[model samples]
Target: MPNQKKTKIVATLGPATSDKETLKAMILAGVDVFRINFSHANYDDVRERVEMIRALSEELGLYTAILADLQGPKLRVGVMSGEVVVSPGDTITFRTGKPFEGNAEEVYMNYESFPQDVKPGERVLLDDGKLIFEIESTDKKEKVVAKVVQGGPLKSKKGVNLPNTNISLPALTEKDVKDAIFACSLKVDWMALSFVRHSEDLMDLQKLIEEHAEHKIPIIAKIEKPEAVENIDKIVAYCDGLMVARGDLGVEVPAQEVPLIQKRLVIRAKKARIPVIIATQMMETMITSLTPTRAEVNDVANSVMDGADAVMLSGETSVGNYPVQVIEKMTSILKSVEGSELIKVPHDPPQIRTVRYITKSVCYHAALMANEIGAKAISTLTNSGYTAFQISAWRPSAHILVFTSNKAILSQLNLLWGVKAFYYDRFVSTDETIEDVNAIACKKGFLDVGDMLISLAAMPIKDKGMVNTLRVTEIESCPV
Candidate 1:
């Protein structure tokens, strides 16, 4: 509706976008979602930023969604003395739950069960697989001895990835529980659980939210662990959304396998009718350089062609010098791909045996009819946002214009592909409500005189039941 690309862009909020002016510019540049990563954020700063984003969204008259990304059981090394170097054939010792000056030979780790969980021959990768170590032995008390297989300069508090060992840590840690509660208090539109091992992890998080929050927020499962990749089908069906967290996933498995894994996850999510995002290092080279590497540009383009709902940027937006420029460039790439036949995503037919088959069929046909007649938009009245997600999954040529009275859902649909949500109440007569939304659409410039609009809504509109009505209207002109 805003002349934007169908594939949304999600930018991580940080020092680069802390200023109000920069954030507004990003919104204008088509950043549909702002992600607040709780992994290394200061709570006070996060609260302040959330306040600013909501205030600015009202001021700018643009709908924006906020995603609270919970840091789940992220293991790391303790503070080092300063920095040390190691080479192949070097030996290092990591002791758990003890204060010690970190050095080349010995360092402290935060995870208390590291020594108990690690075993001989398991590989340990640090600093995003920059340094690799093979476990030699562990005392099973407090010490783990490893030999450097691939080494580099090690520093304090570097991320540790145990690719070969199954560390026994709950998907939601104590910190994550507190963070989820805080995020609910902020009324963020979406919550993403990092390092989600399986679908049960989402149930664990939902239980926590149901206990503390007034409403249940939609969640996105971060598929970063090998276990999550293996359990992707269940995870896709259970969670509201999915994110292919390639950074940690590539470290967990071979880097060469991540591309295929990302494609597979996207397909599963699409079939389940859930939004899936492609994240991590999408435009890493643009962090400092004004332009992205050829490979980086190609990566974002491929994600769009693969039918991802959104593409996310991490350090490139949070700590990069060219945050706004990076978004502009990403948008340019998206538009280029979206204009081509390559962006045609697969369509999933409804299962007649499913209980909701009729609703799904209505949504599917709405999209199909809209495309057949070259309609300008597919308008739908949805309270639960179910039809919006359903129609969006079809990847229709026409934009999915969603009219809803649910205030929380207005922002939630922003992450959906090809969906533009509007806050609409006053469900009067079916004809009157349809006219009301059509007028709003024309005023917003998505439709003009003589444009064909395919609209769907439930009959007896006040009942607010499942979508059961479909109509095609020709927009002549709205009264002054």
Candidate 2:
């Protein structure tokens, strides 16, 4: 149990790593979070994985978080009679409903508003941008006539991308509501809403969660669309966390811009004290090959050096031949880069609101003081996990040990960078809780004799959403 690496790993569970033994191996290898993709799994599949994750975490005595990813309102072509081969310069008709006879000349799309929302000259990408179409005309009926700029064999249910159109689809589909209800019932730690366009899109999901759940499950906005990038400020302010989902994002935006966007998103989340996950194909080659390309290794390392809270593995772990190997390699890369000069460089704290200013200042100062004093850990007693998140954002050299009585909050912290969260029994006094954590740290070997522990907490311990105190103390006693 100890995660010596600063950056966390989020492993998607599928046929490759779903069994109890494989899950335990993945945890031991280095998976901090388990992601259940609703786009791929049914209710039964999700519930089974959720149960297994909980049971395995308890058996292994670890705090592992689970994220439920909503597919959102994805547009795709309906079932084709067979494969349709289209060459460049071919004219095709895209209709909203089922086609009477599916052929190469005509195709059906599932989204009802696709025809009206899309205008002439806008580009339509299919099968992950493998084929491109330029809309030439829109008829009185809900049909679009398009010229294929890049053509290939089109299969049934392949993805459709409207790169140039302002998508009018709602962020939440009927399927998303059902998935959210199911996720809440399982007490999932976080839910990712895909294809978020603006802050309003996030508000819609937030309202749905509030109306359906007793627990407050945090939402992580999947920033993939260009509209989301344009409105990132408002979206970041509204959501609890963000995911740099570069798969569709790379397709939507220019591929060359993804690196800069990833860096920008990480910095924005850091300034806001929200966790950001760099996801999609981090170790993709490992899906088949025993090892990843050297370039892929650097990609994972670069994300860690960019201060990403977590790096995700999609198909690499979901259905790959080397699930555990991918985790091991990713963990190794993170460890190597974490100790490099790039990661040690300090960043200037961004200008923020007054309350956040104070917390960030305290966190920055605590990290400096801990490094100067050779502290073993920066410990925080957090009620809402906000204080711990800020401390992690500061990227302290010392390990972060968060003591919380709230199990849900503790689970959420599992995804935070450089955070090691543990639940403590309820105490009558703040001093009692601090003392208990101090002793627990020694017992758990997170601290050794004479090692310094920088502690942060808020005044009036009963109050939530405040981080106003900092103390540095030396570990003097043995484990209690």
Candidate 3:
């Protein structure tokens, strides 16, 4: 088996990493999850990548997860006949469906509700906030007139962002519906909804998934908008995971506030026992150079210390010159930070009312008990992978062994921290499950003949709410 890190790494797949050998090497380099970006890949491309990952996992006897990221409601300007350059204090008009041809006076916008949603004096950011424009007025014909506050070369099909306006748009677009169905057909482990603004946005995608998918896949909501921050608690209540998509989020909200927001989101997800990913620009400098700047290393370390389950790479692993080197560097940094004294402190779970306090208390005690007794490993039987997530959040010293009968749940466990998941059918009795766990642990070298182990589970097999049992026993003492 390949050596694993406690803080998981999620690497994106693209032109540089589409081959089988490169991907296999990345998996060996400690990549826990592979993300298929729908914005850049077609349906066929996604299917091929999914097949490759599954095949590699089988050949290597390791579990890896695939996340299909849906591009939601991305606003962009239409084509311009020629590149137009505008300077400061220049007045321009953005007319709905009006293509600009060699003129800087007016440009085309496809979003019909732009004029109705935006008001005068609101900031209009284009090309990833490179050019800033303030709305001067709006016309009855659904056009927005603005004066350029900061301007540069404007190209065709550039993205537009309304930092100060809350535009009215559906969470799921027409293309997203098709992509969601196609991804579900491929049996993706997780579906990530981009630019998720509220809890209802997640509900809309959930209904769509239920309509198409035979098995329910988990949803990962990407918090990339200011509205998402305002409704984070409610949004997190509905999704299985959360991703701090800082690329567009930094553009949508204030740049200085993003760091604090990242810490806040990680804390919220940890308290709720949900997997959270910190994504975008994690190792950006590595794309060009083999080494990352000192600040980037500290950024990743701080994210892990803040309790994020995973840190993701976008272009660094996808289209960069040295993809494998980047993963290795990331793995090294995470390992060094993990062993430092900064990570030795106790976990701080939130004291919120809506969280499952009982479950949190139970998982924390299980880890404490394992530490107190110096057990070789901690084992649990889980169906939805919830108990394993709780244990991972506590960041215990002992390795976690999770046994589940569901294959989908088994694949979903790949995103967890310090967890080695296995599938076991035949849940006849609680004693049988414990015996199986001990046998597997000993057989897999996680435990020895005389090593002590900690076993935790809910009695009666399907009992809900809190874990009801915790036992400490010698591996050789458990009856087969």
Candidate 4:
């Protein structure tokens, strides 16, 4: 049996563990949430899975979160002929023509949209960069004349990679729009956007979500591109969370830099107090084998030590032969790290000398005070869920109960660490807000009668940005 840890574990859902029995087993094995990948599953499948997960959560009396990951614009090369193998010296032409033309001198790309955006000297990589091509020239409105810079065997409909070139592609394609609407309708806890290059990308998606779903869904920016890494601070400020998507990232950037980038991303997100999920290939070998490699175990443990709010399983849970075992293994690894002496290493204290955002600064102060006092729980009354994130950054031992009147805000907090959100009817006054929090604390077993608890809240309970009060109150023996 593994030791139980407070940090959350997110397991991706796939054929191996899509049924109710497997999902329940994973949950019992310590899966804190389930990820539904929209890149593979259709709307109907997602709907069914969501309903099943919801039913199981209720039956087990657990508050497991379901995250819907949107497959953003997937840029892929057009279809090719049967099979063309090119050597390093071989010059292959990528033009628009018949696929069956056995000349083999020129290979045609079936994508009609490729010629409109590609330019001369631009590099195009296919099959995860196994086949590399450099655009030599372009014909007017018809074909792209290219030669294979680095050639290998090319297959049909392989994925394309355009690094650093901003093609005129909509971040949210028609399919993405449809998927977002469906996910929002299903009320998924978190929406992870892929291939986010800039902060405006997140803003545009947010606008689309509002137009289609009529609600503010938390957007998690996937950092898989160099451009995204350059503007990561701004992007993190805008989005609700960040995901270190190392698969495409490794393809786009130098593979050796990935580990450093992962460390940087986790630290940056922690400093910003936004939840960061370490995703992609954390346990790749586990997809086939029941047991994980020693290196994989160390990888997961390192991420936990870095203060990641969650570690995501991609194919390991989605299409793996041992999905449940992989999740269980990850949970065990997290527990081992959590109970080890490494957890006691004092985290670098947050810098408050030059605080710019008052709300963020206040939340940090409140969390520091709570941690210093060794409080059993951190109670926050919030409308936007920022306070909870602030406390989560400290990685305190105390459970965080975020009381919010907005269901949207509550759903967003599902990805955060140690946050147990509860919806409350709009409080008429500040006193009512405190009372409501206390009431919830009692019901949730976080507090007992006559226990001293700390409460932090913004005054008036109506305004959005004022957290200026902290109180220490003794719980009344009887209901007042």
* Reference-based lDDT, each prediction: 0.90, 0.86, 0.85, 0.77
Backbone clashes, candidate 4? 0
lDDT by residue for model 1 (120-233), tens: 999999999999999999999899999999988998888999988888999899999999999999888999999998788899999988887776699999999898988888
Q: In candidate 4, which residue pairs clash?
A: none
Considering TM-score, which of the candidate structures 2 and 4 is the better prediction for this target?
A: 2
Question: Given candidate 4, what's the lDDT at residue 260?
Answer: 95
| Models sorted by lDDT, best on top | 1, 2, 3, 4
* Better model by lDDT: candidate 1 vs candidate 3: 1
lDDT over C-alpha atoms for residue 54 of model 2: 90
lDDT of 4 by residue, 1-480 (tens): 122366787888877776898888888877777888887886677788889888887787566788878888786545555676876655656665455442246655654556777788888887877877888777746677777788777776667777746666666777888888888888877888988888888888898778876566778899988988999989997898899998888888878999999989988888777889998888999889988889989989988887789998988888898877887888889877864546532356555664435666666666666667766667888877767887788777657778877766664676787777777766678787788778877776777776666787777667755566777677785253
**Candidate 3, which segments miss by more than 4 Å at Cα?**
98-103, 344-361, 428-432, 448-451, 460-466, 475-480
TM-score of 1: 0.98
Number of the top lDDT candidate: 1
Worst 10 residues of 3 by lDDT: 345-354
Q: What is residue 86's positional error in candidate 4, in angstroms?
A: 2.4
Candidate 2: minimum summed lDDT over ten consecutive residues — where? Answer: 344-353
Summarize candidate 3's per-residue lDDT along 339-453 as a digit string, tens digits: 4556643466536543556656667788887777877788988777778988987777788899888788777888987788988876767788788778877777677767778
Point out where model 2 deviates above 4 Å. Answer: 99-101, 344-360, 426-431, 460-465
True-structure RMSD, every candidate: 1.3, 1.9, 2.8, 4.0
The residue-level lDDT of candidate 2 at 391 comes to 80
